[model samples]
Target: MIELPTLYHLATPDAWDAEASDDYTVSTLGRSLAEEGFIHLSLARQVSGVAEAFYAGRDVILLALDPHRLSARVEFEQVPGVDDAFPHLYGPIPRAAILSATPVPFAQDGAHDFTGLLPEPL
Candidate 1:
């Protein structure tokens, strides 16, 4: 068997909770899988920046996803201005694929403080 890298998704507590079935359909904070066409995922090193950029001043849950458990296709696509390619899941995330759902802490300045929240070498 091949080992797949763990991917991350920053979601609101409400959004994550809404997915009560086997498949999670929410794409991002405000978008749905049907609307966005794909779920945005980040690498460990990109989690902090993504949280700061899109989810600043908000409390979020960090979902650790095991790609090997997912049935959807995970594609790494390069955005127009982004330096690194980002992983996008073409289908809804199955409940089994979520390894962990941890609450993210925030700093005094209303920014997400991802210290100690991510894996090592991040």
Candidate 2:
């Protein structure tokens, strides 16, 4: 399988805009990095499901992050009943790791649709 160079982070616009520093250091809100110890992430195919379940009608942004540039350790962990593992970054993220930030589009039914936002498969 071909591995993409980047991964996606689903974030609130206010959280990203307010907290992301000029130096590229960012703290993810809701993920509770200090308490849970990691920031949640989803693969291209996984974004839709995650949005539907967690974010739903809330406005969110899809952040494109270069995995290689992240200061934290990213791990793909299996959750109960889920077939595929999800990516989790075990530390604060840096702005330099982010390649782009795009608003997550809403479907006619008012759910986040990540179709065009995700990177094409490499």
Candidate 3:
């Protein structure tokens, strides 16, 4: 998979914007993502499990698991059935079910450490 981590769109949106949004929208979006475990990950890799989770069609927290470099965090709408209905999921029944998700720039310092929030050497 070509890890295009440099692509700028894979970023999280600003918090001020969230504050501007109606609380219901934010809470519902968060709930949907959390239910699916859709962690925000770059869409650069084909085998990225994280990417697949977001494909589940729920809003998610996008960020670089690698901490040494700065990255963007953001949310997106998951269009269900569209991923498979679209001509190219690279496989059959490609619908995504998120294992979990979080929304924040700084990785949570506690149990949220499940992802290690650090870069792995290639």
Candidate 4:
């Protein structure tokens, strides 16, 4: 199988901090792993769109995850009404899997400015 690239998860500061265990249980902005059945993830190119659509005008932290470090299985699945397949984690995210967390800055127009947030080749 082809190796997955770095996966990104958008999370609020409070929610990201609340996960004090070895594994993170929160699935998305307002959902949980148990409730959603998986953690929603994005590719480097999808970060800006996901943020604008779901987290506009909100303070969020961008979590860069290393797929190899995660205990959960990451699957690329298609969602209705979306053209591209997104990465979904089948289990809780392990703390070890998190590569870095950076605060997402918003532009004056209330849009998320993801400038330089992603690594090279994005």
Candidate 5:
């Protein structure tokens, strides 16, 4: 399987404070997500469609998102069906967070090809 990004953590801007009981508008990004209604910041773009996927009824490997793109917080471990402090495992790492993303397969010139990598044992 292609090893684009091995791990990922959710991303959101800190526009809102916990003390405030209101939601911010993410429509500025593109479209409002159906479930959480937050903007998908639009930074996950990649060679594979799944890698650059939005959060509308879908799950994409984010690897790491940038602090500039962080408009709000995700309330912690918001990955559907995944409960607990899972997000904490990655901590507050920002977009530049280096990850084991897969190298681009098949160079545009078609002369080079990515050998790919082995999956890290979880």
Candidate 6:
């Protein structure tokens, strides 16, 4: 199977702090995992859309995760009417899985831009 070099997860400051701990076994989506049964994630190409839909005007840190380092299973599933499949983590994302954490940049109009957050396309 082909592996994506990186995946993105938009997280709050608290979540970022929690994930920084060695004991942090769960990813930032603890509540989502328990309630929705999976942690929501996005591909590099889908980042902007997801951010606009859910994280607009909010201060969020983008998590750059290495799928290879993830202890939990990562699946790419399609959403209704969406052309591309999105990455979903079946379990909590271990901190080690996160290669880097950077604040999502915003444009003058208050729109979030996800460009340059990841390395070259996979």
Candidate 6: the clashing residue pairs are none
| Global CA lDDT computed for model 4 | 0.88
How many residue pairs clash in all the candidates, one count each?
0, 1, 8, 0, 9, 0
Ranked by lDDT from best down, the candidates are 1, 4, 2, 6, 5, 3
- TM-score of every model versus the real structure: 0.91, 0.83, 0.20, 0.91, 0.23, 0.82
lDDT of each: 0.88, 0.76, 0.28, 0.88, 0.32, 0.74
| Model 3, global lDDT | 0.28
Query: What C-alpha lDDT, on a 0 to 100 scale, does residue 61 get in candidate 2?
Result: 84
Q: Is candidate 5 or candidate 6 better by TM-score?
A: 6
lDDT of 5 by residue, 1-122 (tens): 32223333322233322233343332322333443344332223221322224333322223333333333453334545533222222123333332323333334554223233323334
List candidate 4 stretches off by more than 4 Å: 120-122
Candidate 2 TM-score to native:
0.83
How well does model 1 score by local distance difference test? 0.88
Give one digit per residue, the lDDT tens place, for model 3 in 18-110.
Answer: 233231112122333234343323332322333334323323354322211222233334547434211111111111212123442323432
Write one digit per residue (lDDT tens) for candidate 2, span 13-103. Answer: 7677835475323334464676677888877878888878877888888888888888878889998989999988888777878888889
Q: What TM value does model 6 have?
A: 0.82
RMSD of 2: 3.1
lDDT of 4 at 87: 93
Task: Report the Cα RMSD per candidate.
Answer: 1.6, 3.1, 14.9, 1.8, 12.2, 2.8
Off by over 4 Å in 3: 1-60, 63-96, 106-115
In model 2, where is the ten-residue run with the lowest total lDDT?
22-31
Model 1 has how many clashing residue pairs? 0
Per-residue lDDT tens digits of candidate 4, residues 1-122? 66778999999988878447658888888899999999999999888889988888889999999999888788899988989999999998888888888999888788987888996662
